[model samples]
Target: MVISPPEKPTRDEKQSAGRNVAIVALFAALGGMLYGYDTGIISGALPKMSAQWGIDHTRQEIVTAAILAGAVIGALVGGSLSKRLGRRKTIFIIACVFAVGVVACALAVDAWMMTFCRLFLGLAVGACSQIVPTYIAELAPPQRRGAMVTFFNIAIGVGIFLANLVSVVAAAGDSPEASSNWRWMIGIAVFPALVLAAAMLQLPETPRWLIENGTVGKARVVLRWMRPNRTAAVEETLQIWAISQQEDKESRGGWANLTQRWARPALIAGLGIAAFTQLSGLEMMIYYSHTILGTAAGFDAGLVVWSGLGIAAVYLIFTAVGERLVDVVGRRRLMLTLIPGSTVFLFGFGLMFVLTDHPNRYLTLALMLAYMACNAAGLQAVGWLLGSELYPLSIRDRATSLHAVALWGSNLVLTLTALSTIDGLGLGPAFVMYAGFNLLSFVFVYFAVPETKGHSLEDIEQSLRDGTFLPLRGNIASRIGLPDNRITTGAAAD
Candidate 1:
């Protein structure tokens, strides 16, 4: 018997399916928010906790970097859990873990206890970062997948912005107990975690994953729910099953298989992209933005709050812009452009600090915003999207696990190193080191990374197998080979 390809949906049918996909993507985006809130909350809370806990710089680094270390463990284990428990179920479990971690941190009696609790919180954050975008990508139709996944970053920025706003307000109140204010900061995460856990019950499992696990009938049911009135649901389910089965025949889905011929290059590229993105020192800016602003620029707490908010706003806007254009501009081009641009900004930032005894404060702020904007446009928006798309379905789970581990590992090292580097070497030297990393990243992307903007997972897999990089093109569809009818015409349509 010949298996037919899935038929393309009609205009009305596409619209109907798109609406449902949007709703589910929004729900998944909440996971992104939790990841951002958990990570960014410490930025504001750290100062208050320092005075209350009487911790030194070294101890402070340990407290802040604990989550990143836990994230490495979480990312390593999260894939196996997703395979056993299902993606939606695993995410719900992670939400519970996040809530528990929040409570532990909020109620901690000492710095050591808070450090231990942060490891648990990092585990949840790490898992969500791996699972949420993959869930969104698998459920979304090819046409809108980029936009759907990009929502993760936007949600993350919103979470960071909210965390900062909350910190500013909490600190401003000058509670009778300043130590207690930090507790509120950590505890605020619990409300969102509980809400996300409850909200997930309404979501269906990925039809593709259901089919992969030998539940074709259940997969069909899920596809129907996701695509409601479309007759294409059955056909889409079958095609996904076929691709998954082909992948299964090639290798077992594990770390061992990740080294096989078909998987290795993609694994390297994915991990490299993830690592380089973190090594750009973006998180250093994020987790220590308050301190950097106050010390480097000699800004006060109020100025730090305002400047941080401004940076967050720039990230949000540029991330949205990048997400909208990712399909159009292609991933390689964006990275090629943004990485170098970021390096230049970092160089300028360091130089500004060194050259003038007291540099023009306004110029420094403008340069900082430029750095944030350029980062959001490229590394922040594109990193996860490319990482998710680079691997074949057979090893996607394991590959993403590895990628997440590398990302957080680099994050942990950078976070820990930044404290010592900033304190001992000074802010200028610390930033110069990051600037050097970005320069190396530009060369890596130019030589090793391929354009994956318009291509399907199968196409990307085939390209990797053949050692072919899809040529950069003016129109997006040319790179991915989407049928003209399937392409959205403009940014407005997207």
Candidate 2:
């Protein structure tokens, strides 16, 4: 059955398709923004909630950890929903949840009510973390995939930065009316939620997913919109069709597939990275910088709130930097370079706490910002990207579900125990413990993680089947026998 391939697309068609992909990716990345705002808002709102509700420290911890509990459940269930409903629909559902949950939180009358509302909101947060990167990765071309998927990460930083900025503004006045400002902080997320829901209604399903589901005709249409021309679109659609058929014949895609010997490396890398991302203590800083600074470090109230704003800015800036460098430097090398610096900065931050009850404010702030730059640019940037890209297509949805569970579960444990840990061990020892975790993360990456820069998703899958996924030989690209052009710009012309 020989057939002629379609002609290459015209220059105008290529430019148009590029614009379509970019627009879609940006709209979908709004899911990440909602995830960030909903989760990060709590840090600033919690103190106000405590002041208004007269909740004790134990109750305050419960309120903060509530959403985390729901996130675990959301991650657990997101796999089935994504597989059955499709990514676009699942995201729409997540958006609706975000909208409803935020409104409920804003209307809460007591601590328990707030906990219940945030718990409900966490479902969307957890699902957004799991699904948005995968959706973006599936939409983008191999060369641009790193940057596109990272748009979700960047949007998250945007949400967090906005949350902190709002908190700073809300905290400006000292009257009793200030206690009510938490409602505004929590409620503002509804607008973005509504916006995301509207956007998802217009975006196309990823061609890879359509091919997987045996709708080659529709997949070809989608590829046309995403790729440069008719020829490129048909070629990619055929490739995906071939891979999907082969996977169907050889494997049943589900939890059981995760246990196969060939899938073990990906499982180890994806799950390990997910856990390490949370255990790095970046979330602790995002969620509790004010507590760490004001209560533990003896900073004034204004400085504490403003320090949170500074922390958020550093995260947003470095995550943007990492987006540009991920493909150029390669993922494994970038992590290796930045993680050690994170270890050093965190260690220095802890040492100051140990040395003096009143550590110099500027020194502590400097160390925190430095730690943030290293952590955000490295582990934080790569964690979600790797999770979205690492697994074989057959098991991608289920694998990402498990990845989300590991991330949210680790986060839940950390947030639940952070205040108690600090109270019991003191801030110095607690931070030192986190620094040790960063060192351990470095060791894990060096031994097990492989560089995936400039490789196609199918290419990575083939490496797994061939038992050549590990970087045990040759230069980074040559380890996988990639062409030099792919190793560089991911374009044949390069």
Candidate 3:
């Protein structure tokens, strides 16, 4: 009998070899915390800033959205920069930028100056949002990739939760002096930003990025760092290198490459998924939650604080569930399940808003919570993950950058429009608009989006090129020509 050599350990097997990947993921996730803290802090801090600066609603919206606007630019620039400078380096730069922006925000003396500072901070937040998940995805083993990248969303929820909790505590004292504590709320981010920046010094650069840049030796070193004892580290590195070389040979990997015939559908799918995710009106609810709760639901400030906390908590929980289910049910299935659920919730919430004369505060709050739960369980958790997964590694950075810009740009517009829409059309009409957007999303996903669970990046690229919108599941190992048992028979098998 011929004896066969032992099978090589795949990336997924290496995931359990040590805690290095987890540690790296944790540090990278700090960038997400800053993204969340900065965005959500404005919700509570805006009212205080408006009083101090004596700005009108329009001006206040501008201040609140200045960071988002800056993020649009940051996402575009950061995506391209990460491709050149490497993911780890790009995120390090983002951390430093965040630290600077936080300090500037804390020290601003006037509304114009504060807006200026916010624009600066927005760039950091935008860059973090774009780069952190990509970095985590690139570094993570495919088996745990979804869970690892989901940390970004988790960090975001935590950031928002902490911001709200701090704001409530800071505003506890009943006096003029107590009201200005919002500044401190915004300033607290500086500590985390600084910590994130400092921690990046110890993390390894992404092995994939290294290989893409013709630094194979460096890539091997980094791979070893991630999987110290796995002999398959070098094999996986070579496989990735082969894929990158093939991509480069076929396409020059330029901006024009994304517009080529083979890449267009992937681009459209990425951008559409991202845009529809925002169109769900989640950011609008996030930015104006306090105002909406107080005005539409007739909840007081104390109730708004509690409600905000509840929203964050529920968001975190559902997002966790979504993360676990993403690899199991596949991206398309998750979208199919969650989009209709979100739409129904939004429609009912809209009707409730329209039907009741002086709607019951608790009932309205409950409906809003239901809407948030649906969003968190679906769009918020899956959107970024799907966007990151849909594109080939060749144009992944550019595609992700474009998608981030679209999402944040839509968020900027929605944030700016929320107060106006509420003032002009009332809460019911505003929700009705979101309900329509969600309905449209349901149609788009059902028709256009493909399932990507368990497919390798290379396999996904082939599927996109072949115009197969649905994933071909089962025996993916043989279909993709990967070794049987290379990946554990777990959620990936589903």
- Write one digit per residue (lDDT tens) for candidate 1, span 1-494: 99987566677876777788888988888888888888988888888888787898899899999999999999988988987788899889988998999989999888999999999889998998898888888887665677889899888988888888787777677442255688878898899889889978879888767888889998887777677454667767877877777778764636677777756767776788899889998767889888788766688778887777777778778889988877887677787778878898887887787776577777887877887888888988888887777887778888888889999999999999887887787677778878899898876766556666555555566665665533333565454433222212221222
Pick by lDDT: 2 or 3, better one: 2
TM-scores of the models, in the order given:
0.91, 0.94, 0.91
**Which candidate leads the pack in TM-score?**
2
Worst 10 residues of 3 by lDDT: 482-491
* Local accuracy of candidate 3 as per-residue lDDT tens digits, 373-428: 88887878888887767788888888889989988898888888888887788788
- What's the lDDT for candidate 3? 0.79
Clashing pairs in 3: none
lDDT against the true structure, per candidate, is 0.80, 0.86, 0.79
Better of 2 and 3 by TM-score: 2
Look at candidate 1 and give me any clashing residue pairs.
Answer: 454-480
What TM-score would candidate 1 get against the native?
Answer: 0.91
Error of 3 at 101 (Å): 0.5
